[model samples]
Target: MTLAAKKKAFVELGKFLGQFASSGSAQKPDVLCNDPFFAGLENLIHTAQHHNGWYTPEQVFFAVQSWANALTPENLDQWLSRYDFAEKSPKTVALILAGNIPLVGFHDFLSVVISGHKALVKLSSNDQQLLPFLAKYLVAVAPKLNDFIEFTDGKLGHFDAVIATGSNNTARYFEYYFRDKPGIIRKNRNSVAVLTGKETREDLVRLGEDIFRYFGLGCRNVSKLFVPKGYDFKDFFEAMFAYGDIIHYEKYANNYDYNKAVFLMSRFNILDNGFLTIKEDTAYGSPISSVFYEYYDDLSDVTKRIETDRDQIQCIVSGVIDYSVPFGKTQQPELWDYADDVDTIKFLQEI
Candidate 1:
């Protein structure tokens, strides 16, 4: 399709989504659920929440627009062209999605479909709605593409390609399972920030949002911060105080309390200043109650260290250097970027 035609369809899709966002309902198909994907989404959201999974409309908007813009035909085509999808068509791919954050796996799903391949999707229990809802919409828009996509939970037997995302342990499982197949297996990757004392209150506030959103369960959540030694924690804490409400997540709060108690009892090296807790560790993971902020002697050297560790990092949020946008917002990825650090269309074409 021409870019113009695709954009028009996207505009229509966006309008439909906006209406749904406002009405706060998805019962009727011709309305918000007109796309089959949304219908599945409605059912999925109901199921997810029913089973202790939490998703917000704001997160849904983040997912929808992120998918809409990135997976649109034009953008998909551009990414495909970079790796030559035209020469490699009809690849069958099995996608194992991650649900740590809302709709984290949709981009891989889109890459396979838009590149004209068959997708064997294994849905993550954490996220069961948006992908199916989207698949239905795509088929509705172009019925000719129906057989190109399928959703299944079975073994991805003999599939020519694979894309999987999971934790470090699960990455091992994926590597063993799909070793023969050409694929990309991504493990946990966390995003971080380097906070210079020069940051304004506004920047701190936004940075807090990046860290706290989704209760900091996402891979892109700012799990750690690099700060200059002797930095005044009060200034940063004051700006982030509004997000104290995030403590309401009973499970998350429980984690915080548990970790804090353990640290106090064991005399573990940790910093606590009433609200946020700090610990020093080189691991990409962070505890629920607190984020780890380490002191850096020199900004440039520390930035270089982070660059060396980029494989473990998803994106960095900072005022000093250009980085991909912050976490929570990472789900709303743009058209150009690829997820799990893999090129989608290239894999699809080969299949």
Candidate 2:
């Protein structure tokens, strides 16, 4: 398929999904939640609910709608149309997905499928349903795609290229396993924030979303913050209180309780909200449910510090900068926002 044709197919898929965004719910989101195969995704939601963290059919629907909306041709043109994929097509592509966030590897999956390559996908147990659902729908929209995409639970054998995402530790494993192949190896990365005194009350609340959404398990989640010196911590505290509902998750609550106790036991005077932890640090990443904060003497200095670490960061969500939307929405990405600084389409074309 040409770039224009692929774009059209994706837009059609997006529109079809958007139609369900209003009132329908996924029948079974779980069976396919960790498996990227059409068989598992056929009826996914209900079967997966008992596993962990509450995710309703309605929420899953919206998540799909949000993903589809972002991938529509219009949005794709805005964020990702720069990469032309007509020339490079891999004979085979292996994709390893991250389950930390839902549908995290969809773009890569689409890039491979659209390029007419056979895909070998290893589903993330944390996020199993999305890819298969998408694949099934793609086959429905364009039957030819069926011959191109395949989901698997086995090893990626004899693939011409590979792309894998995992923690820093797992990255080492992928480096050894796929070392001989042409591929991109991504490691554990955490996004951060640089807060200025000018932030408004609403801005702080959005920051809470950036921190609390998906229980802060996503790479895009802000695990740390840089506050301008003398910045009133009260603003952040009050803002986070607005999202008190997020603390209801059993796992999240447990994480907070455990971490908080550990802090007190060790005489760590870290700032916390019973949901997040703050401390003096120059790092960008944090654990699933904790946040770290450091006060900076100057705003420019903080920016410079972060710019130096930009290569290590995935996305920067901030209240002080003039950017699109607000915080918690960082993971609710726009179309074409490639993850880990790798453009899948471009990679496909290069091969």
Candidate 3:
């Protein structure tokens, strides 16, 4: 299929996704191929939690809405305009997807197909349902796309290049296994927020979305915080109070209880507000239901430190930090906001 056809198919898929939300699902007759496909999608959205505990209807709806907002014609055009797709031979690109969040590997999948490459996708077991259904939808939109997509359950083989995402240890394995092939092997990376004590109540409240979205599972979720020295967390805690209802989720509540007990038994000083915990930590990755924090003397010093450890960080969120993502926007990455700061489309074109 031509690039225009692929783009049109995804735009239609986005419109299909727009029908779902935590509050309800609505079917618009104008959406492409709405007959049985829309009904199937609605069922998937409602029953996603049955397949995965973390894939609650609300979380799944949020993910769908995020993608719906992203896959507009304007956004797709802006993102693809910078890349040149000339008379290039299409390669079979193997994709090892991550399932930490809904459709986590979708950008890579879209990049491959839109770049005129065939995708040999290995779906994460935890995320087995959504993408394939969407793939079917795309094929229904543009029958030619059927030739461009394939999903594999067995061992992956016969691919010209690879794109893999996994934990740090698994990433090492991916690097070694795909050593001879052109590839992008991603490892564990977390996002962080820098606080300057000047944040408005609204800003911090919005920041709660950055922290609690996806139940703190996605790499884009703000897992760490950097605050000025002697920062009073009273306002921070108060602002975050709005999200206290998150503790009602059984899995998150379980993690909160377990982690809190472990911290107490270890004699580590921690600040808790029943639902969330804030503990002084130097590390970036924090446990679920808790966020790691560090006190910084100066923003410049923190900037220097972050620059040194850029690879370990996925996104830096702050209102004052230069080039940092704004608060509450970490999870809503634009089409051009490539993960690992590596352009997937460019990599696909080159390989």
Which residue pairs overlap in candidate 3's backbone?
Answer: none
Name the Cα RMSD for model 3: 0.8
- Clashes in model 1: which pairs? 37-133, 37-134, 88-349, 90-351, 91-351
Arranged by TM-score with the best first, the candidates are: 3, 2, 1
Please state every model's RMSD to the true fold in angstroms.
3.6, 4.5, 0.8
lDDT of 3 by residue, 10-90 (tens): 999999899888787888988989896988878887787777889887888888899999999999999999988896889
- Top candidate, metric TM-score: 3
Candidate 1 lDDT over 24-80, as tens digits, reads 754444543364455555555445554444565445555554554554456545554
lDDT of 2 by residue, 191-269 (tens): 7877777887877888887777667777877888878777778778888887676667676688778877777798877
Tell me the lDDT of candidate 2: 0.70
For model 1, give the RMSD to the true fold: 3.6
lDDT of 1: 0.69
Once fitted onto the true fold, the runs of candidate 2 whose alpha carbons sit more than 4 angstroms away are: 2-4, 20-43, 52-62, 87-90, 319-328
Q: How far out, in Å, is residue 344 in model 1? A: 2.7
265 Cα displacement, candidate 1 (Å): 2.4
